[model samples]
Target: MKKNQNFRFEKKNRTKLKIKIFSLQIMEFVTHCENSESSTTSSIIPEMETSSQIVELALSVERADTAALLGADESNIDTLEKKRLEEIRQQQISQAKLMAERRQKKAAMGMEERQNWEQEIERYRIENEEVEERQRRLDIDETMEEFYPKLCEWVGLSNYEVLYNSLEDGTNASDLNKKICGEKNVMFIIITKTGYAFGCFCHKKIPYPKKSYIYSMYDKKYFTFSLRNPSCSEPIYFKQKHKGKSICIWPNDEKNFIFTTKRFIKIKNPNGPHGTRSFFHGKFSLKYKSKDHQKREHTFFTQTTAFDVHRLVVLHWF
Candidate 1:
């Protein structure tokens, strides 16, 4: 009976130990489930809000001023950027207003300025014309002053008499008689509106200026040239051989004479010997380097004025 009682006690002790072990297992399972649920809930929720994240959200909503004031950056970078943009906008507005004001001022002054500009142009043109006319007179004065001094040098006269000067008397002999024409043994130099001159000695007292060739005294021709005729070649007389003009006392004083037909006793080209000779007359070509000597003579008939002369000892232009 005691052995059976010991066996029953051992079985009861074993049953108690199994019950405690089962309770421990159940407690552990519940704790693990609670921990997992708590971790999952924590993961679903969010962390506490930071200052930079709040600033970013505010700026995204176009509230930069609020973001900048409440920011932890402490730099006020947004405020500085706003001020710079405002300044640029103000500058553009001010420039547009200034340009409008300038346009209005120019429109108001246009008519008065146009009138003044026209007046200024007219005055300038008149002043320019006056300057030109003054220059022309000065040129004529210079030419007149030059001709007389050069005449004295060319004539090389030791003693001479000025019996008449057309400038003092008159240039035209057509109105006056032969009394105005100087006496025999007198010489003459005619100054005309044309640039060149005409000069000769009167062998006898001529009645009319047009018929003075019959009384012509001078044998040599005189003219001005830039280049000297240095070649010592003989002269060719084309008019004498071709046109029956030999030993001519040219009607140089006659204004009505034909221009091309008028001839002078002179060699044309005395530079060098070449094939360039006058027609019908070789070894002599009546070349004219300067102005035509007969052209100056024609002026004596109509416009022969302002002339003076001296007796030539022996006139030969060499």
Candidate 2:
């Protein structure tokens, strides 16, 4: 009996110690459940509000990104328009330079053509002048050959020497005078045996008888005469009177006589002694005889009386 009671008491003490350790583990599990339920109930409304705020911030960020993309597209369109305008201005400048260069080339070609035409004209003028000079020289030589010989023959020159000698002497001069006098009909022809020639008259054949007169007054005597043609109606005569008993007389021919009275004169023919009567210068004068008057006065006093007068009259008519 005693051994059985000791074994039972020891078993009961071990069972009570295990039962206390299990009760402590159960109390720790119940405290953890109550703290988890309190934490979940307190944070439920605050969590919902924070989630709604985050969704609104995300939508605002998306709208800002879309506006930045649209601004970049507008800037690219403006830059493309400026580049196109610059390209059009550069093309217009290039075309203007090309037209200016072409105009300069055309003007230079026109000036060269005008200079060539002037040179051709000058060359033609020089050639024409040379041809004219040659033709002029030929004409002068032909004219000299055709006319020179005929001119010499017409002047009656067999040679130049005969013409020169005849001109130097006076023989041709006298012949020329005879030809001129014959042509004018002023020369009196004398048909001699050798040839025809001329004659002159004696002074007694003159009709103005007063040429042989002498004048006397107060013991002084004077003689007078004149030169004229007797056949002409206008005869020139000179007269004078003497104081002494000297008589005035004149010759009518080689053997004839004329005597003066105061108012009348008597003319005797050469063949007879009988005289004819004529009036004087209205004065009564007497006639006397003188043999010396026949030899000295009648032969030498006459000139070639009518030759110069005929020449002057013919020239006046011509």
Candidate 3:
């Protein structure tokens, strides 16, 4: 009976050992399952974060495109608005012009307004004529604009008409007499080859010349001036002293034709090829250079006693 009891005790201990081992194996299996679940959750969390980031980038790009589209729409709208305003402005101008044309046509068709229309036409014609005349005068003045003011000051007149130009008209004594004789308030401008410009103004009418070597007259309102002189910086002027035969005319002699003033100056053979010899004395003379044959020093209004005439102009001062 004791042997039987020992065998049963051994069997019970073996069974208890086997149960403990089985329990340990179950705990290890549960630990392994937990580790695998944790690894899967970690990997899935990273993938979820990456996916969320990608979605956010896509949303940002969409927002940018939307903003860009909105900006483009606003720009297009502004451009259309400007074009519409410009078109409206042009239409308004056209309408205004059409209305004016209609009004003008209506006013011109009425019979009672015929006289008024005719008067308006006459006024317009007069205005046009005045404008043309003003332009013509301006053109003429521009020809002598350089020294016109000085000439006007010397003649004591603001208005004048060029009557004769030797370059334009024939350089003859008969040509000068035709335009100048019997004309009052006449002026003479003489340009010399040696760079001297001088002139004289006569208040009395130039008389017709007689059949003689020299014809002369007297006038108190006669004066002489040197516009340009090599020796003088400013213009030189001289008034008549005794007023004795201040105007001399030559009618027949073309080559020897000249103008002279008694006790003042004598321009000999003004149109001659040998040039002219002027003797300035008393009130009309000044210390000047000479261009004579002997090169004699002379007291005159010019640098040279003998000078070739470049241009001769006669003007009627008004």
- lDDT per prediction? 0.38, 0.32, 0.65
For candidate 1, the per-residue lDDT at 299 reads 25
lDDT of 2 by residue, 1-318 (tens): 998888888866754543344344435546655767554422332232355543543454456667788888887887887788778777777877877777777777777777777777777777777655434322322322433254233322322211111122222222222222212111111111111111211111112233354322222222222222222212122233333322233432323332222222222222335432222232222322223343122221232211111100000000
Model 3, 1-318: lDDT tens digits are 999899999977865554455445445656766877554333232232356644654575578779999999998998899999999999999999999998888877775588888899999999999877444433324425757787788778988888987777866677777888889899887766554667778898888866764544566678776666666546656665454666678765556556655554555555567555545544333322223422222344465445566667788999
- In model 1, what lDDT does residue 55 have? 49
Off by over 4 Å in 3: 1-143, 213-216, 263-300
Q: What number of clashing residue pairs does each candidate have, in the order they appear?
A: 3, 14, 1
Question: Which wins on lDDT, candidate 2 or candidate 3?
Answer: 3
lDDT measured at residue 195 in model 2 versus the true structure, 0 to 100 = 18
Pick the winner on TM-score between candidates 1 and 2. 1
Tens digits of lDDT, candidate 1, 48-115: 25657434443544565567666845577777888999999999899999998888888768867988
Residue 113, model 2: lDDT of 72
Clashing residue pairs, backbone N/CA/C < 3 A, model 1: 236-284, 268-286, 268-287
**TM per candidate:** 0.30, 0.22, 0.46
